[model samples]
Structures are given as C-alpha cells and as structure tokens.
Target: MINDDLTHTPSTDQTTPAVATPDDRRPLGSTGLLASPVTVGTSGLGTPASADGSPAAGSTAFATAALRGPNLLVDTSNAYSDGRSETAIGDAIRQGGLPEGRGVVTKADQDPSTAVFDRDRVLRSFEESLERLGVERIPVFHLHDPYSVSFEDASAPGGAIEGMLALKEQGLVDAIGIAAGAISVMLPYVRTGVFDVLLTHNRFTLVDRSATGLLEEARSRGMGVFNAAPFGGGLLAGRRGRDGKPATYAYQAGSPELLAWVDRADELATRHGIPLAAAALAFSTRSELVDSTVVGMNRPERLEQVEALRTTLIPDDFWSDLEALGTPPSTITD
Candidate 1:
C-alpha cells in the first residue's frame, strides 16, 4: 500500500540549481560536457511510485513536471519498469512544452547478457527509447552501471561499451557516459578520458563521501559528474507513514549504528532549521565533485522539495558537527 504521509504531505519549498555563473557553466568533469546544475532523474517517470518507491497520486502530473523543468537533464534506462518509464518520459516531452534540439539527457541499458551489443539489438533499443520519448537522439546516452561492466563484456561480439560507441559513431548519442555505483570502477573510466560523463550514485551522498576522491579526479580530468541518491534512499527526508514505516522503500534500515545516525541527523536538522535529506543534498552538491545532482521526483510537489536546496549551504560548523559525531550512520561503500 502507498504510504499515507508521503502521499499527503504538502510540497515544500526547494532550492533551484545554481544558475551557471561563468565558472559554474563550464564542462562537466574534464569531458567538456556542459549541463545545468540540477538534472531530473526519471526513475519515477512512468512508475506508479516515486523514486523513493512510493506511489504517486497522479502519474500524468508527475511526468509533466519532469519534461517542463528548467535546464533539466532527464535520465532514463530500458530497465526501468521494462520501458514504461521511458515511454512516459517521451509522452511528457511530446505533450509538454520542453524545448527541442537540446531536450533531455538519457541513459541506455547495455546488459550484454541480453546480447545488447548486437548491432540490431543496440539499434532496436535506441530506436525504442526514441519511440518512447519521441526524440530524434539522446543528448547524453550513458552505459548504465559501469562497475559491473567488464572489458570482456564491453568488447565482446555484443558488449555494452561497443554498443554505446556504435551509437556515438552513428550520431544517435551526442555524448557517451557510464552510470556507476562504485568509485573504484568510475575512477578508471575518468582517468582513461574515454567517456564524456559519469552518473554516480550512493557513493557521494549524505551518508558517504567516498566519491570525493573520484569527483576531484573527474573535475581535474574534465569529465562531468552527476551525483544521484543524495538522500540515502529517503532516510534523510524525515517522512514516515502510518504504522511507523518509512515513506519510501529501502533495504531495511540497518542496526544501532544506523538508528543512532538517524538520531544524530535529527539533531543536526533541528539545528539547521531543515530536514536531514535537504541537508544531505546541500552537502552533496557543495562539493567540487558534483556538476549536477539528479533527483527523482514523482510530482511537481516533489520538485518543491528538491528545489529547497537553492539556499542551503553546509557551513564549516556542519562539517565539524558531523566529524564530532563520528562516521555518519549511512554510507555507500560500493
């Protein structure tokens, strides 16, 4: 069942992505890929639920928000609800008044076990994504999930990387990238200077900072970095449902350490006059490591929450408090 609190809460005010100052508008990472500061992650696009995995009251309303926003970089993958999400996004773009030519930045799934690298399969998927979105080409086409990407898998007769390179060669994808979960895997890609962008999650959120090193490296290398999952899977949102469950779905909140961290986060939020999740996004984006922070929203109301970061800045004191409290209760090591 959908959580009551999540479904009913009023949309809160949010911080908009910083307008690109001359310095801010520069290329993402070292790859020379320019983008807006706030990108829309389409995890919740066609889903019955939000990105945190909660059902939304209106799917049509949710999709419209994703397509009509400012300087949005919309992300999608074939694997999201078996293309329902992509189709919904396409519908939104076609129906909503988002600009064309420079419309959305989306991702393509390259699960080679499915023989995705086969030229026919690759073309089919790309075309399918286009058919779903009603776009000619994706501005940014990322090879979703790099940590699991193998050189063997990428170079094999029908591998993910090869398929992506093919798309790039065909001018279907304006830029090539990888969406990664691990710093270890992303580092090499950033260092190689091959791919143009990196979509990273969990590694650079409120609960963890391991992506700090990689973010720095990517910046130095001139590759764009998109930070995903800033709320640690909604734990920081401070939203809960009836029956005392969280407003979103996640692996069960861990042990005493996690619970204790939640307590500390509550204390911290009270001090900051904001919720822990807002603080999390503020912390994640304040870093030089991030070019854009991709947030999933199920409604325009949800965008209000994401927009709240416009004024949030982590003071030195906030960092000091976190250090004193010990490693945060949440972390994304993988």
Candidate 2:
C-alpha cells in the first residue's frame, strides 16, 4: 500500500552514490550524469488554459526560472498534456537559454489513442519530443507507462524496450530507464538490469512509503533513483491546499484520519520552528536510496519558495517527534 510508513536508514555501502546536496550536483548512478538534489517537474506547466488552445499563463516564466535556477535537471514526459509540457520547456529554452551543464530528461510514451508501444512508435515519439523541445538529444530517456503492453511484449525483440535501447545505442539519449506509477510493474523492469535510471513519484513521501522496496532494489542494481512528489501531493507540505478544503494526497481527498496526522505533524513541526514541508522534502533527499528528489514548481513565484524549503535545516529532535506520531493509514492507495 502507498501509505506504508516504513522508516529508512542511510546505506552503509561505500559504493552508494553521494547524497545530493543543496549546493552541489550528485552522480546519477553510473550513467555519467549529475543533478541537483531537487529537480523541477513540469507536469503542471502544460495544463490547457482554455478551449482556445492557448498555453497556461506563467508557464514559460516558471520554466525560465527553473531552467536558470540552481536545479541541474528538469523532468517531463511526452505523454504530459499531450506533449504541451515539452513545448513549454522548449519555449522557456528559447526565451532564456538553458544554463550550462544543466540537463532535461524526457520519456518515450505510447501512442495516446491507439496504445501502440512498438519500436516504430517509440522512434516516432522520440523524434516528436526532440522537435517539440527544440533539442537534438536528451540526457535521459525512459519507456513510460509500459502497462499498455505486458512485460513480455515490452521486452520483445521489436517492442518498446528495443526502441529505448536503440536510442541509447545511437547516442541520441545518454541514459535509458523506466518510468511508471505501479511499483509492481516498475520492479520487474528494474530487475531486468538494463535500465540505468528509475523514476517513481507520489510513493516515497513522508505520509507514504510504498516505493521503499522499489528504491532499494533499484539502487542495489546501480540505477539512479528519482523520487518525485516529496510533498505527498501537498498535504504533508501544508495544512490546507489553495482550495482551502483540506490537503489531498495521491490525487484524492485526504481522509480525516490522514488530516489528523497532518495536524499532529504540523503542530510538531511548528513546535520545532520549522515548516512541515521541510520534513517532507528532507525525507526524500536524506534517503540513501534516492539520488534526486523531484518537486513541482509550476509558477515562477514558487521557485524561491521551493529553494528555501529545499535548504531548510530541521532539528534532529523534530524528526524524532514527527516519527513518534507515526504515518497516517492508507486511505488512497496508488
């Protein structure tokens, strides 16, 4: 279940990659890539503003800030908002060029309408993503959401796996990996020992830890792990969402019990003079299993806020107190 409150201890193994720091880049497994402790996620930037087909307001501005900010990586997918997310990143690059040594990681997705995940479609998807992003090559590419096809089919000779590997063989993408929501599905891909990176979101945050086993497994195989949504979709980050209807987790309504846990955690954090989000974010960044933590910064104004929170120093006693409260029960399993 996603609501697992399993605690983690940092790895003792010397070969484990360096933990990402606020001011420096950390290695992404052995892919010869490096990224900041925090990576800007762009799923929200591609939201359709209206029936008129205009991009959301402030999307480009936010992208520009992220591109020029301290972050060394920006993560997106071809399936996000039917490819508008890449367009927004591209526009941001054109408006204010990507900073030196920073990288953009994208994924190859199946055809939306037909659900075709073959080599031909993968090739087409990569080309289209490059065109939309106005880039000739990508640093890391993934086979996203392979549930459309069984593991057997995806690993077939002419399947999407071949397509992603071909991209790496051709030097079009520096690294290749799997990005998916289901832990069961992702575990299989990670066990194959072919992927260089692994991206899992909404499962490694403070209130939930369904991705615990997955992260450990991936790291043991020498794969970089990106843990997204350290805020648990904003509940663990704050008491109430912008809607003021209580915070939500995993895209569903936060249960009263879950809200109560947040309330208790909030008081605990306040008593220690720290915002709750700091603890939430630190949970991911401090984990030995995680190489990078991906957070959503969809607006220009949020860049500074996230940066501040990313660097906040919470007392160790506060973590002890927060842990004493225990995690909320799973009401919305991923």
Candidate 3:
C-alpha cells in the first residue's frame, strides 16, 4: 500500500531553504537548465520496506522540502517503488508549489521481472512518469538501467533510446540522459553522443573513484555528469558514535576490502573532527566534472544536515591527508 502521508498534500511548514536563483544557478551541461550543485534524490522516499520486510517510512515532508528550494533538481525514476516516488513528487508539488525554475529528472526503464526493453515500453513508462509528476513535459528524461537488459536491444532500431529521442524531437523532453550502475555498459552510449546527461552512482566517492574515467569521458563529450551516492552508500553517511551497520556498496553487501576502506575513512573523520558524511559529500561535488551531486534523503532533518554539509568548508590539508590514505587506481583530474 502507498503511504497515505505521501499521497496527501504537504503542509507549507515543511518547506526548506529555497534553491539558488538564475544568476546563482550552475549550468547543467548543454541542456540550458540551471540547477544547484546538490540534487535531491528521492529513491528512499517511496520504498515501503527493505528486502527483509522491515518497515521503511516514506515522507511527503521530505519531498516538500526538496521542492521548496529554487533551481533545485529532484531525481526520480519509474522503477523506484513502482512509481511511488513520482507520485510523491506530484503530491508534494500540488501541496507545496515548486520553486521557480526547479528541474525534475525522472527515468524510464525495462521491468525487472519481464526484461522488456522496447519502444512501446519506453514511451509508456515515460507517459506514466509524466502523469505521476503532473507535468506536460519533463526537463530531463533518462533511460534508466540499460545494463539490466541487453544494452544493444535497448539502443537498437525501434528501441528505448529511439523512443526517447522521438519524445525529445516532439519537445516532450528537453534533454535525454542515461543513468546506470555499470560503467562499461554506459561508456559506449556516452561515446556515441546520444545523451545530454549521464548519472553514475556509488562508483565515485571518498572511498572509491571507479567512475573517474567515465566522468572525464562524459565531460569531454559535453555531457552533464551527476554523481550519486557520494557517501559510499549509507556507510559514510552514518553518525560517528554508532558502530557501523553492515555496509552496502552499490546496493550489495560490501566486500571486506571496501569495508576496510570505510573504516579508515571513519578513523580519518574522527581525527579531523569532521562528520564523515560532510567530507564524502564535499569530495564528490568538489570535482569540476560533476555538474551535480545527488544525495538521497528520507526526512526533513536529513535535508538540513545535507544543507549544512554543502556549505561547510574542509581544510586543504584534510584533502591531502585523505588522498594520502589511498587513491583509486584511476586518476581523477580536476
């Protein structure tokens, strides 16, 4: 069942700080859409339960807070909670009006169960997203998780990418993008120059820089890059005092090496007297290649913490010490 709180109109009291205005907004590649450096990721806002059937609370207040900001970008997908994320955003927009010039980025992908990747599915998925978002046109529509199915199937003639481009030509989507977990699968499309934006998550962060090459390639092709999960999933985002919960990397159990890497990062945070999450968030956004860093939030308090982390300045020596710990094999140039 969908959470009733997410279905109802949100109160105005739930608003957060407004997004940056036009003059202050940062360019999002060649799309001409100006957005804040930090995008609000809504994946956690609509998932009803964990794989263990543990209750996961979804909040309209979080959506309201995200939309209250000016020039902010809200990232969602039809796959998230079977489209509940988009519904929550629509309800929030109706209850709490969206800030001027705010951008909404949603995605269409094949059904995990069916593995269907075709033009009809893509168009139908996008139509559902538009209805759920309560918008006639979307600023950015992404082809989500192409690697789950055959990338060739999704990109071939009469495929998902072709459908998305058709929508773009019709002015339904200002720009099309690709968001996926597999860098190998995404690189081919990135090199093809079909997408205006690219989003890679859990691959580029304080503990990992696996996507550095992909980020560079996308930037070289004039594509906007949005880096997600800067905290190495929930590992780097947890409070300092608590024993780290079982770490999950890229939505899977963290390997021993990954866990060890996070432990070292925790130790470094303790020494510097900085929140681990603050450093993680800053590291991802500090890179010139990243046009925006998306962070998922489930509560208004989490949003407040993110805002603080964005403005908090870390010393140069902190970065130097961080780099000394160990850099990923791939070189990350500014």
Model 1 vs. true fold: TM = 0.80
TM-score of 3: 0.86
lDDT for each residue of candidate 2 in 249-316, tens digit (9 for 90 to 100): 87678888888888888898899999888888898888888888888757654656777887899898
lDDT of 2: 0.78
Output the lDDT of residue 46, model 3: 58
lDDT of 1 at 193: 67
Candidate 3 at 104: error in angstroms? 1.3
**What's each prediction's clash count?**
18, 0, 4
Q: List the residue pairs that clash in candidate 2.
A: none
Q: Which ten residues in a row have the lowest lDDT in candidate 1?
A: 1-10
Clashes of 1: 18
Candidate 3 minimal-lDDT segment of 10 residues: 1-10
Give the better candidate number (1 or 3) by TM-score. Answer: 3
> What Cα-based lDDT does every candidate model obtain?
0.62, 0.78, 0.73
Model 1, 223-264: lDDT tens per residue? 778887666556656644438664332334445676667778
